[model samples]
Target: MYRTPALLAPLALALAASAFAAGEHDHAHEHQPLHGGVVVEVKDVDYELVARPAAVQLHLRDHGKPADVSQASARLTLLTGTDKQEAVLRPAGGKLEAAGSFRLAPGTKAVVVVTRPGKPAATARFTLK
Candidate 1:
């Protein structure tokens, strides 16, 4: 029932440090994309998918920084009602882009799979609005 200050100080510091680490991990998936798009976390990486009338772009970020996905390839599948379409995305600048007219309405469902030469594939699913 008797504890010294030296013993309590280290215990308090350890608890505070653990709480801070938990907070950081909880906020890792709550990132807002620089470009207006939907962000999904795949294998601890953030992938922001932007659907436009003329193109579909996928942006990669690792720990809140831009990730080089130039050597990566991606496949996008879009489903609207009973219709489905798929496209191959090629690297363009800082993102992977596929140039085609896509029908991304409020209820469209999308699934994207990205693969690199020596890395396992990662998938992200989204519903458009």
Candidate 2:
């Protein structure tokens, strides 16, 4: 009985250590964006924003799979130096898009707020070039 308890102690400690280490593993390894865009995590969902001069695009992903945004709406705020602009985004082909002239130079800051029916709004912030 004494030997069995002693053997189980080390096994329990090893299992605990492994569980701790697994929890400590970096989350970045799982959030890489397929599109060349800046990504932010909010409420276990990944929002990838692609800014351009002609339009701004936002992609949604959940657990590395494309998420449906057909019933969602978004608002984008862009800040560059002292100039600021806001646009309302609508769902377009599995992504959210706003068509407008935007100043998306390097160091520009963007804040995106997305809303869906019966769900709380989700927000993400990004700096883009």
- Using lDDT as the measure, the top candidate is 2
Candidate 1: clashing residue pairs, number: 0
Clashes per candidate, residues 3 or more apart or on different chains: 0, 0
What TM-score goes with each of the models?
0.76, 0.77
Superposition error at 126 for model 1 (Å): 1.0
Tell me the whole-model lDDT of each prediction, alpha carbons only.
Answer: 0.87, 0.89
Over 1-129, each residue of candidate 2 has an lDDT whose tens digit, in order, gives 358988999999999999999867355536776778899888778999988899889999876678889999999999999999999999999999999899878999999999988879998999885
Candidate 1's residue-wise lDDT over 39-127, tens digit each?
88877788888998789999989778888888998999999898898999999999999998887788788899999777789999988
Runs off by more than 4 Å, candidate 1: 1-30
